[model samples]
Target: MRNARFLWELISYRPASASCRTLFMLACYGERIVFGLAIQAFFNTLPQHTQMTPELFVLFLPWLIAIAVRLIVVNFGTIGAVRFEFSAQALLQHNLFKHILQRPGFQALPDSVGNTISSFRDDTAIVVELLSHLGETCALIIYTSVVFIILLRVNVLITLLVFLPLCCIVVLARQAQKGLEKYRRASRTATSNVTGAIGEIFGAVQAIQVAGAEQHVVAHFHTLNAQRRASMVKDRMLSGALDALFGNVGDIGTALILVLAALSLTAGQIRPGDLVIFLTYLAIVSDFFTDIGSLLAQQTQARISFERMTNVIHGMPDHQLVAHHALHIHDKVNEESAPPAVPQPVVVPLQQLVVRDLCYRYPETGRGIAGINICIQGGTLTVITGRIGAGKTTLLHTLLGLVTADAGEITWNERPVADAAAFFIPQRSAYTAQVPHLFSDTLRENILLGLPEHEHTNDLSTAIHTAVLDHDIAALEHGLDTRIGVRGVKLSGGQIQRVAAARMLVRQPALIVCDDLSSALDIETEQLLWDRLRTSRTQTCIAISHRRSVLQRADQIIVLKQGQVEAAGSLEQLLTTSQEMQRIWQGSE
Candidate 1:
């Protein structure tokens, strides 16, 4: 019932479109009644009216007019269906993306990438496919009722005989429901498994080769394909059988009506023209049963699609999947006109930021930051340094709300932050992760990803210079316009880091957070990077680094060990007082 309601909500998403589609489609189907009556009249008057008689011509005229009318009705009905399909599809995709973006940045998605793709592409489409048929189904219902009344007036026994097939069709459809739903679900699952395995194979090609598992991988792929083939065959076979069953049942009913009409004709109980109309209307009525069967089958598949979509979204309410939202189908404004101005974000200067009792633990490993504390005043460099696996990256991720904290309090200039992920955005706090992500686009676009080039043109230049990427990019043939291939794989490791740093710096956030920004740079480049950053005196910075140049220049240095802050002070003080700090400092040498 809940799934049915969701489908109804989608169909009626744009009421205006739904109404036009139904009205126009009815006009199209209503033509069938006009033509049916005209044919019956012509046959009945054949003995009374000679060739080219005015009476028969009168009936012929309406049939001709209906032909022209059908042309227009089908055209408009097609328009309505097309518009509704696109709008409903846009709404579902919009909601899916919105829900996906709302999750914590550090949390992995519930489904594999291929499965999510299938949910977005296949699952959403099947639901809308059911919606597309609804207009015709409504028109057919009205057409069938009118035909039923016409036939009942002609002969009571024949009317029941003609519609008996409809009952059989309904029973068969009910019987096929379990198989239809089960096979559809199995087919979709098998398809998802095959697609997921393909994605995994692509991502792990190097590992597979290193492990000499090529044959094993091939065997696994073959297995998945076999499963998909078997499931699809069953699904299609069952669906086809239902269609054939409806057709054969309708044919048997038609034969019975013809035989009964012949007997009545022999007894002079019915006119020959009455049999013509019966056959004519019987074809249309037969269509109603076939369509009803198809609709019931599609309903079963649509329910399965909805269930899969809900799973992709981590069990979000089914209504959310089809929730009504604005679908900007077309641009209302003229292209020659100026585009609307974008509003800039508000920026507040940071006096100091404080964190107390911040804690988070990995459920799998139970080794994450715990009860961490820190304070940063404006215009100072605060470097967080630690050895490998010391929770340096985790601390940064936890505080920034990329990962949810188990317990914490964050104060930004005396204001408490309720949501770190939402609050720590561009112009407030900009962070560069240790392993940065880049798209297969030009370096210029990647650097100004969030910041508009025209608005932040100067910020672009300053950030490039600050991150020491200006020299590297200038060395390239196309400079910043050069396309960095997928994930910046074409660039050296150091260049990728610098491009990411420039991306973070361009926003000119009040607080700068970086995780091992210098991990890939050489000593001289690292030195130059710090020198450029120190030149900016008003912004606070928290970074992960173990370089002596960074250690010596730090306004405060924090050393982490085993998920806790072991010591925190200036480089000189930490070297003198803390054994853990001394070991870390010596280890750097």
Candidate 2:
């Protein structure tokens, strides 16, 4: 029942092609039935002819024409089936990518990058195979049913006896299915781990070589590879065993049918032609049983793949699940009449943003920010400073809705934060993460990502100047057109961070949230970056920094200690009144 539901949902991705898929399958079955009838007709007329007589020719003509017509239909059906399969595969790939991208926040992905690739590549291909076999499985059942009925009419007792062993075959296959599923799941996981490891190792090959850990990394990879091989071998062995057992059962059934036919012939209860037809039909039935066994085995693997994909795509918190379902239904109902949703422009409120009694805790360690209260005024630079692990990053993440707050109230423009029209980092409110990511593209493209092409030239120049990256760009051989390589490997660490900052600036977001944007920059570059930011009085800035220069320039400063707000004021006020703030500033100096 679960497998049936999985198959239905898998095919539901391409509803328009459903009819074509069905018609193609029916045509295939029709071809098989016609071929079987042609064989039966030839056998029935064989004993009556010494050579090809006119009467025999007349008898054969109808079967020949029927076979020819079915063959033509089969050819057309094959073309349709292939087209549908490719189309469905493409649709599934697109949907998977769309779903992954649409997930709420930066931490939305539930699997490693390699696992996601596996789901997109290997898992989707498996689904296509399952879909193809699903159609063939249906056609096989119909053909088997017709052949079995013919066999029953020929000899009821013999037919019943021949089919009895199928029960045992099914039971054995069912038992093997559980083991096969377990092995396949394990094999898939192993494959994902190996893929992820290779990606990580390759991306950091220089570091590995520098650290002299090449042998260690290879040994770890070999262990994972060996595990995958073992799991795969077990899965394949179990599937092959089931197929062999079913084939042997089919052979036994045929032997029993032949023996019964011989007895019936001797007793004059059946003619030689009858025996010929019965044996030919028996072969068809035997082939059906073998196919069914193979289909069942393949299904076990498909079921695992389907479950893996659905779990990743659909698994979410209960509230999120309900919201997702409601949104899906809404979209489906209004899809035809409704215009596509355009992203609304980010409109920063020109009023105070307030956080009161905000609290959030990480599940793993049970430690996060708690009872945090602060007010951020628009058109001001607010700096949060603390030692490492003081929840600066977590506070920013929670405020941006990247992490759920366990307890709190955040208001923007006197409205609840959830109801307010404010963009978070990497969206309308641009963010430069502590460790920024850069694509392997031209510097111009990287900075101007998702911005309109018309604004590209001006925005790119302004952003580079603001982030103090113009000098670096000028040093590059191709200027802004230079390709940065993977993760901006060709650039220095400080340059990568500035490129990220420039990317944020290119968006021209009213609110900028940066985490340690100057960590890698020298004092000269860092000072220039802040100097440019200070000149932008119309934009609001929220940054995490411990630099004395940044602290002195901040319009408001909030110091955190052990996940709680230890101090909040201008730099001078905090330095004079709070010992912790004094220590932090003195340490920075």
Candidate 3:
């Protein structure tokens, strides 16, 4: 049922195109029936007239006209089909990617990034191509029905026998369903693995080179390709075998019709003209049945694609893949454009953000934060300090709703934050990761991202200043316009961190969250970063930092140990009262 609904969604995505293409296809096939009738009429009159006559010309003229008219309809249908295919493909890809962005940040993709890309690229096209077949599929069904009725008039028994192959082909397709799906799934998985490995290898090129593991990486890559090649051959071989099987079934059905026709002729119930028409149209009917068989084969594979795509959106309903939204196909593409955001019930200024009895545990390792409670006053710097595996990052992730807490309550300025994921966003709060993501675009564009020019220019200067990026920008060849290589690989580690901080600052978010924001920076730069930020009395921050310099400046510190808060107090108080704090502080020194 979902399969049918999914196809219909794609077909009806562009209603005018669907309707026009259907009508055009019908007229195109209708021409074939007219041609068959003309030829039959010529055969019927041969006994009375040996040569060409006005009657014969009259018989042939409409077929000629139908041929010309079909040319127009077919050309129109082809144009519409091409356009519809592209448009529908774009819509599905857009929706799939959009939903992925809406999901929580901590949820990993269903598979590797490469597998997800395969679903986004290949699966979408497969589904849209199914819609592309609708016009021809529908036309064949109607054409075959009309052809069947004409044959019934000539000899009903043979007509009934013709349908026997159609039934057999359906059964054959049903029987092969499991094999088709299995091979297709294997082939797609193999492709994803290969693609994912290539991406990972490329991203870690420096590491591989430094480790002198290039030969090993190449050997591993070759292994993945070999697996892909084997799976692809199996997948293709099975598809080809099915195609040949369908064609043979149609041929076998035609053979039965031939014997029936001969028997009918001997009984003197069928005329020569009728036999000519039946023999002429038998191939067409056979081909239609073959098409029906192939369509069934496609459905099996399409189901896998549908499953993969829905799985990408965190296992949302399949209908949402084709969910209606403005595509803006005619407009310049906007990164932040909608499908509009879900409206938040309340948007308030940050004063005090509170978390009470928050709990979460990593399912795989069972070493995450539990019963965590914390508070943040607006315009103050609150630092979370802990050793590795202490659930420091996990607690921050819970506060941002990156991971769903097993149990917790969070409030902003005394108002309950029903959805931490949605509530903690730009202009209200912004979180920067330990390793920030930067694009291969101009340094300026990386900071602005999708922000408008007018809006960004207004705040870009202040943001650059506060992030301590002004000096770096001035030293660069193009300053703000410098094109940073992929992931800002062209910049030093510290520059990337500063750029990320500038990006967050440009939004002027009420609350700034960072997970070890200074991990890549030197002492001087790190101090400058904190000093600049501290000057802003209205800026509130929650960051994970074990660096003694950063820890010493915190207004309040939360010390975590084994997923629980070990202590919370000023740095001086913790230095004397908490041994864990002392150890962490010494380790940093």
Shift of residue 161 alpha carbon in model 2, Å: 3.0
Tens digit per residue, CA lDDT, model 2, 251-275: 7877887888788878987766566
Report how far off residue 543 is in candidate 3 (Å). Answer: 1.3
TM-score of each: 0.90, 0.89, 0.92
Task: Evaluate all candidate structures by whole-model CA lDDT and list the values in order.
Answer: 0.85, 0.77, 0.85
Assess candidate 1 and give its lDDT: 0.85
Q: Candidate 1, which segments miss by more than 4 Å at Cα? A: 49-52, 197-220, 312-318, 332-342, 361-367, 385-390, 546-553, 571-589
- Pairs of colliding residues, candidate 2: none
Cα RMSD to the true fold for all candidates: 3.0, 4.2, 2.9
Q: lDDT tens string, model 3, 297-328?
A: 67777888988888887757667888877677
Q: Higher lDDT: candidate 2 or 3?
A: 3
> Where does model 2 exceed 4 Å of error?
1-3, 12-16, 19-22, 86-99, 104-106, 314-341, 419-422, 425-428
Give the higher-lDDT candidate: 1 or 2: 1
What's model 2's TM-score?
0.89
